[model samples]
Target: MPPVNASREPMTLPRLTEDPVSPLSPGTHTITVRHGLSRIEQRYHVAGTGPVCIAHPGGPGIGWEYLRMPQLERSLTMVYIEPVGTGASGFLADPRAYTVTTYAHFLRAVIEHLALPDVVLLGHSHGGFVAQRYALDQPERVEALVLYDTSPVTGEEFWSAAVANLERFVQRHVDERPEVARYVAALTTRLDQLTDEGATAVLRTIMPAYVCDYWGREEEFGPARRSLRMYAAPTRGDGQPFDVRDELSAVAAPTLVLVGSDDFICGPHWARMIHQGIPEAQLTVLDETGHLAHLERPEEFRSVMTGFLALEREDAH
Candidate 1:
């Protein structure tokens, strides 16, 4: 199928509504963006009077709930965007709308609709992909970037290496851990033939591999299941190779490339590539943490993020 031209469609800016007395908090607001045929709704959990931080969750389809860091609320206004095809957000009429570029465009519209003077972008995993694209597309709008557990790009080589690393890690644990062995055995049957619901289940089972202290602290990170079942199929684009290494140089926003020391998917190797690609980008590999470092190590993540934001604020002054 051909990709849809979003330009030709009648685009609607996001509608912002703030409750007189939000049950959750004082500055919480709901912003709904009407795209070509989809209405994307996001929750802006405004906490502090400080800078606005727009956060995007991973999974390309996952809701933003997991990315919520209550600790940072004291220092930053966190706007959690519900990407299209997930949560309160509506589905796109076009499958091609699932691409990274379309997501960036949608995000750009959100920022404009909100009329934010300046903002910081926080993207986790796949969210990092969209954040990077948006920063590249509109460098001026972004005050800074916080990329957590993501890579410069996603292509065959990256996936291949990631899978190899995961296999190695799982193998080492399989002998001593029966649960790990069972999870590995289930992969052959579940991964290749996955329904939307099945995909979520499979992900939850495999999430242990993504964290360092899975055996001891899995529950502390909370359940991996999302409130809404993600549109899994729309997320997997064509097998054609994808990479953004060439475009990284164009991103002018001060970027913080953060990754868990043990994150196999977007590990240190990929973090280094991103750091080397973008000019003046800072890299921090949090020790003993995995892909979900922010959730696993909230205080450390907050310190690292706020520290970067502080420097950006200083520079602006």
Candidate 2:
């Protein structure tokens, strides 16, 4: 990775299929996995064999391209997957297929397919919703959880913030490519309808905090470039819909709730709620950061994660 430059926008995203080396450590394979299904492809980078770390991307149509998994992957065999219609994964025309519960099933299949034992499920934002559901469905499969900037409850507040962001983004695009902007505008409007189908595009816009500002290959303006590409992508078919707050208390895995003190969408209050509800969950808020705490504070992120891994290993004995 190049050094950070505050002047120019980042170049186009790196082809995630290529094997990229980690800066923190060496000896890792960053490759793509081909599932039989056309839309089932997953991209991951693996390092050590101590534990399996599976990460879910934040948005409906975005992949885990810019995520700071290299640090973690260098520590363990890390897996980061792009959902259908985003990143390296196959695209789908149906947006309704991106629901929370069905995503859990995908996660379960990935775990079983990989033949992993005692997995660590780490999710950010929307991924947290899926992680929560996965732990509820297959408690025994997960060894630990690290949730960053996730909401404990879902409703208008979430959609409202999403719509607002989309509106601003659409306005910027209107000048550059009116046709694409119009198409995106239609999708954004559909989001206000709040149907399962419309929610997918809106979800795409809501994710990817401007505060994160990390685009892997991009030295600067990485977040802005990524946000633009994400807006134009299509969504996947919808999946099952259900809230898991009532079921959160049943999560058996040791969890670490990592959050940004300045995160507006999923604020400290939500973190506290999740920490209070989960029997073995702990919350840590990063100061002076917004939604993407991991990127804003990568060293801190690794510190908390590595420490928790040590604690879990010690407890297992």
Which candidate wins on TM-score? 1
* Model 1, position 198: C-alpha lDDT score: 66
Scored by lDDT, model 2 comes in at 0.59
Worst 10 residues of 2 by lDDT: 1-10
* lDDT by residue (tens digit), candidate 1, 1-317: 00000110111212335653642334545567676666766444444445678887777656555565667877877776767666556667765567777677767766886687768998888878889888887888888998888887777778777767767887888777756665544333323246667656655656677778776863453344222244465455433444779999998989999999988778899889989999999999999988877667879988999998999889989
Q: What is the lDDT of candidate 1?
A: 0.69
Stretches of candidate 1 above 4 Å error? 1-49, 182-193, 222-229, 236-240
Colliding pairs, model 2: 94-236, 94-237, 96-237, 96-238, 97-237, 97-238, 97-239
lDDT of 2 by residue, 118-157 (tens): 6888888778888888888888889999887887666666
What's the lDDT for all of these models?
0.69, 0.59
